[model samples]
Target: MTGSTRILVTGHNGYIGSVMVPLLQCAGYEVVGLDTGYFRGCTLGASTTSVPAISKDLRAIEPSDLAGIEAVIHLAALSNDPIGNLNPNWTREINAEGTVRLAEMAKAAGVRRFLFSSSCIMYGMSEASVVDETAPLAPQTEYARSKVVAEEALRAMADDRFSPVYCRNGTVYGFSPRMRFDTVLNNFMGSAFTTGRVEVHSDGTPWRPVVHVEDVARYFRLMLEAPRGDVHNEAFNMGVDSLNLQVREIAEIAAEAVPGAQLVLMPQPGADQRTYRADFTKFSRTFPNFEFRWTARKGAQDLYQALCSIALRHEDFTDKRFTRLRWLNHLLETRALDDNLHWQIEQQNVA
Candidate 1:
């Protein structure tokens, strides 16, 4: 893939996608977006970049949608554990089944490179001190299981002609047009910025590998343009070793970013204890020159500034549009989307 290559980025209207699309466009790729538009009006500040987009569901993707596309960056999904827990079958059908369906069509359409945006959460409650690409996957949630299942199915579809590369990402955080405050760092930052308080429900001992959203986009572009032999059918843990921070440390960073902010930790029963420290040795060795630009402190500060610019209120911080599960539930309650997560009204392609 090169500047001249035509790439289809699914979930272009999403949190990472909203940021990634503009970066990709500026880098000179001919980009086309395909999204179900669940977060169509979920912009936090300004709207996302407008590109040629297929406003259709992942399950409803057609062969014609793949025409002239040389590569595919698969990102569309239910996107989080809460949303997955809301309906496990929806996650399976969209994240797992919808992915395989897209890959099958992309392969049939002569699309060569398929970059699956996977998550490191698939290494559920990892017993390993440092989970790498080769670590045994122990998915503990519907969302994690969906990613595992999707990666396995994609691996089976990999061939000489259709190369499938999995970029398993850490907890991504930063400001974007389609902003999400549900992520760890972003959530903390939002709470601190809006209410001048950062709350941690867990024991704050769980390890989480965090990465900035811009670096994620840059790394994806690198993977897209790298030599096919270097990334073919490969899985790379997409972050640096230094990014592995504990929940308490992250909370401290967020609180420190906001002046006069308070930090509170209230450990309760069944609080999220999923912990994973990702080893990015493979990604580091593969892309030796590539550097992770933003640290957690830097990202938290950046988000703090962005939130201040918007004058984010308590209501905005708690807005359903910024949380995937709550937003989908809103759609369902308002009859904008059905129980199966499909749009109830007609959708038109955006250019």
Candidate 2:
């Protein structure tokens, strides 16, 4: 966890990873990136920091990829529910199987700390008001199921030599080089900023724990540096209790952040009602001094300002590059990627 510690961040070209790599580098950690280049050209305004990266698929990770790596921050996956629904097998293959494969390789290579980038979405439709780490995982979608399966597999792999810590992050928001308008808050912010309207398809009763991208990176760094005894083989719900907001509340915050944005709730039957309010008591207790800097309002304002600076248009907001499912579908339809989600043609260099 010192300045000399070399970290391997998978999916370094994605939303969170794009933000995370630069932060880690600025904090003095030697960072290496590994990504398949699915969202390679997906930059919002400015480009992310470039690092020495292995341009390889997650499922195709080789042992040499882990060579000289001290810790592994596993973020590569199908990434979202719609993409998971697109093909369950790909989610299982890459997120679940690929994670274990990479962990096994990291363990063999004498990598001490393995930080799994997990999600609280695995606590699907919990009856409990505030679910914690001990909450039963009821993954409704293939995406959530992949995280659950991968966490279980990683837990089993944790031993004296290999320490696996699961950072169960919430719905992450805020700006990144590889920006995503697919997540709830980010989606709402993008719509509010670009279209001057925040649209809610559901009744807006579903609850989601939202976290800022910067705070997520900082917390992961904390986990990486903390004593192994504290975080080893454990799962921490990565957000504060105050960050848990209902869909309507999030939309309101987003709408309020934009100058002329209106809030429209067109509740339809059978909308995505998956809701869970994560209890971050454990995270607070573990990282006592650590603070979540961004609130829903503040994050919304930040996104609004960033969008304003870039002069983001409705076309850019609806661009496939910023949305994972649409972009992957485009890749498949265009035959850039095969049916197996593997790149058929050579990938272009990430800008």
Candidate 3:
């Protein structure tokens, strides 16, 4: 690939996509954003920076859709545990199958680099342990399992024209133009503002590795430019070692960022079970000298400022529009799938 080669970013309007488009453009790379604009046409546009954009979904992607694209950065998906939990079948269809489809299309179009925005949550909240890339993956959610499947499928390609890189992102925190209110740190910060207390439904024992969204996007940019042979068929865990925090500690950071915000821990939710601290040495080994810049405190502070800037009230949280249950309800109401919306699978099928 030549300098300033064209790159196609799927989900280019998402939380990380919005930030990455500019970073790539500023670094002298031509960017083409491919998105269906699911988040209200909010995905980032090259028009905003030096890159141009194409509005298209993954399944309908044509050869022309990827014309002149040297790399494909795949980030499109339902994008949350609650969203995945909404309809596992829908999640599987979109996240797992859709990713493989994009990879096949990219390879067909002569694209050489493929970066998948994966989740470290695939490790499953392990009890009494730390996880590395080799850690026995015990994913507990449909979303995590889908990601694992996507990883295995794409990496199976192992072709010269098609290289797959997995960025196992930690508990992502921080601000984006397309800010997500559902994330742990962002949600906590949103709750902290003008609230009685930041409630940790969990007793705050589960360990979570954290990273700033912008930094995670930076990783994508780096992988996009990396040689096909360097990171191909490899998965890199993304996050700062210092940022592996408990829910309560994250709450503490949030409280500090938002003055007078109190953090209160409660009984743990049954659905929240992953608790392993991750060793990012694998990524460190892969990249060799690359360093992460954002810490949880800096990220939490940034998210707090963004949340406080919004004029929201306590009623918003309870409102169906902003709550998980209602969001899932609305998704199901779309009748996108005919299967049971609830987690109805037998334990055998789920694994």
Candidate 4:
């Protein structure tokens, strides 16, 4: 393998990671995985590939774990608002502090490229027609706040050797070994497939930039391949302007994908109205040749087919393993993980 071939992808067992690890392997990179295996059981289909992984918590990631890794694609986190709302401190400790600690360890171990998986959700409820990398962060939820904090912390660590690139992704959709129905597009698609109804909880005017899991992996590869001068300490909003769509648009697409699936619009008080249209000019300019293969309609159709192929039932759609919040809540309620989100003694022994 080449010097830059040995890459460590944290959250390699999670949604994007499950898809990404195999893609990286096919591209001739020696990929090592780092995940706590919290959702290893959450499989929509058999995984395409596997890697030698460190079954360790992000908070406990030691310097030795970074020994042979050349680059780091950090993706492990509490994941979303509901989970973060479950315990804000858990998000703060794991997502924010753990990210800094891992980056610090990577820097000390001479890992050159640190690709931090960030979210466009941090541009919280912006009035700007199009929020870009230069837009002021107004993180509303603990989950979004953690990303902002992680990026800020990583920025301070960037230097001549340690180059950290933040890829602020739009809401990711499509099939993964570790599938999720928590994200907007995926949730709508799942509902359409399983229940024959795609429900829009809001007025459907909320704008969300949704990207495919494969595209996310592709961009991560591009980030790794880009020159040091081009990407060093840079932040790029992932996804194109064409991807930005209203909640109703996404639901309609999902409904269309699954024939006979009804679309229900129920705009209510205090519904999730978080909206933002991300400007992807920087990402477009940086990687002029890179193409995003999956559009919302295509992805929804693909997801519908995937769901149908699996014979996915309502029970499976509601399974705790596939939903991050429900899974985490199950772990917490069962005492598999303590209040701090650390594994209990019994689980620790197995890990």
Candidate 5:
């Protein structure tokens, strides 16, 4: 293995990391995972590692934790929309403030490169023909705001010694070993397998961009190998054409993947917080050798197939009690553990 391949991934216990760790290993990276795997059913990699990163706070991380780290992929954060909304202050602290601190620390620790996994949701509402990297941002939520801060911080920190790559990705789908049924694509599969229909909570007419988890994770590995000048300080929106789908359209596409599935438009009591389409043209052009691949259909189909293989049922999706909003409310109302502690107590207490 190339000695320079030593890699450290924060959130290695996250939905993305569970799959990403193995993918990195397969690509010849000597992987190290740093995480607090508290998401219910969360796993810290496809397999355990001797160089395990304990469930520790990023702010309190010891200098020793930086051992052998050459490059870092910062994936740890409070990612769910509802979770972000629950305690905006807490979410910002970790997702935004903590990220800045970690990036500064990583760069200071002699790491040559850093990759940040930012969401495409940063472009809240499209104002232009389409959102290229230069498009003005319309961040709709606290989480998106936090990411925006982190993205800016990354740009500010870009210099000769440290190369930072920001991947502003679309909504991710596909089965994860540390599987989360919370994401839109996963929720669609979970709801359909249980209730025989996918519910569209919004008007279903908004334009949204979607990308498979495999492709998102794959792009990280690709960026790792790309020439520094070509990859550093640049943000790439990962995916092919951004599809303008009404929630109904996505439901229909998802329904086709699983037999007898249907789309039910759940009337919204209020305005929805998320709705936007991205312009991935700049990213495509940036990595001309890098390809825009994977369709939401292929992702939905792959997810549905994976869901069926597992023994799950309707009760799984209907339990809105576990929804991000519900959990956030529980934390706020009950004051259990604290406003900032985990929202869900998992099957193993780690997702």
Candidate 6:
């Protein structure tokens, strides 16, 4: 975990991974990235800091891919619910089965540390005020179910030598090189900045424990450096308890960040009403010294400054590259990626 240990980060070209890889490198880790390059062109203001990478789909990861890698931070997946709803089987195959396969390969390759980038959305819609790590997983969507299934699979694979830690993160929001406007807070900020209006589609009452991307990266590093006994087969809600906010509060903050932005609540039926307030006491207890650097309002301001600096346009906010579902559909419709989400070999030749 120290002395410049080599680590492989899956989904390195992704929203969180784009920020995390460079952060790990700066923190003195020898980092390599593994991604299918699906979102390679999904750049916002600048490109992600490049690293030694393998451009192969996670489902197709071979034993050779684990060679010389001491640890694996698995982040590659279908990502969100809408994307999972597009095709449930794809989410199952790539997120659930693919994760098990990668973990097995890592274990066989003598990789001691396996950090699974899990989600708090696995807790699902709960009438309860707050749910902790031990709460029953009620995954309403295929995407959330995939994470729960993957975590269960990993729990069975843990042993003395192999430590699999699940960092169940909240809905993450913050600026990255590959900015995404899909998550609630990010979407609000983008809408506010580009159009001077933040729209809340589902009554704006759903509770979401939002976390900053930089804080997420910092906590992942803490997990990477922690002793095996401390993190082995453990799941921690990866944020502070205080960061939890209602959707309306997030939108209000987003609107406040932009000078003339307005907030609108347009409750619609069939909208995503899944809500959960994560209890992060375990995270605080585990890493007592680790401090969260950004609050939701501060993060909104940071995102606003970044968006304004780039002159983010209405067209930019609606671009296919930043939205996971739209970009995947574009790939499918244009025959860039196959139905299984792998790139067509002949497409490059045609181009």
lDDT of 1 by residue, 241-344 (tens): 98999999999999999999999999999999999999999999999999899999988888888888888899988988899888888888877788888887
RMSD per model, one decimal: 1.9, 1.2, 6.3, 1.8, 3.4, 1.4
Off by over 4 Å in 4: 1-4, 345-351
Lowest summed-lDDT stretch of 10 residues in model 6? 342-351
Error of 5 at 200 (Å): 1.5
Question: How many collisions between residues are there in candidate 5?
Answer: 10
Error of 4 at 77 (Å): 0.9
Give every collision pair in model 4: none
TM agreement with the true structure for every prediction? 0.98, 0.98, 0.86, 0.97, 0.88, 0.97
lDDT of 6 by residue, 19-118 (tens): 9998899989999899887778788996679799998889898999999999999999889999999999999999999999999999999999999999
Ranking by TM-score: 2, 1, 6, 4, 5, 3
Q: Judge candidate 5 at residue 318 and give its lDDT.
A: 51
Model 1, which residues run further than 4 Å from truth? 346-351
Worst 10 residues of 4 by lDDT: 342-351
lDDT winner between candidates 2 and 6 = 2
lDDT of 3 at 233: 84
Worst 10 residues of 1 by lDDT: 342-351
Give the higher-lDDT candidate: 1 or 6.
1
Per-residue accuracy of model 4 over 16-133 as CA lDDT, tens digit each? 9999988888888888999988887778766546689899999888899999889999999878988889889999998999999999999999999999999999999999989999
**Candidate 5 off by > 4 Å:** 1-4, 40-51, 242-245, 267-269, 291-293, 318-336, 342-351
Backbone clash total for model 6 is 0
Cα lDDT of all candidates, in order? 0.93, 0.93, 0.73, 0.90, 0.73, 0.91
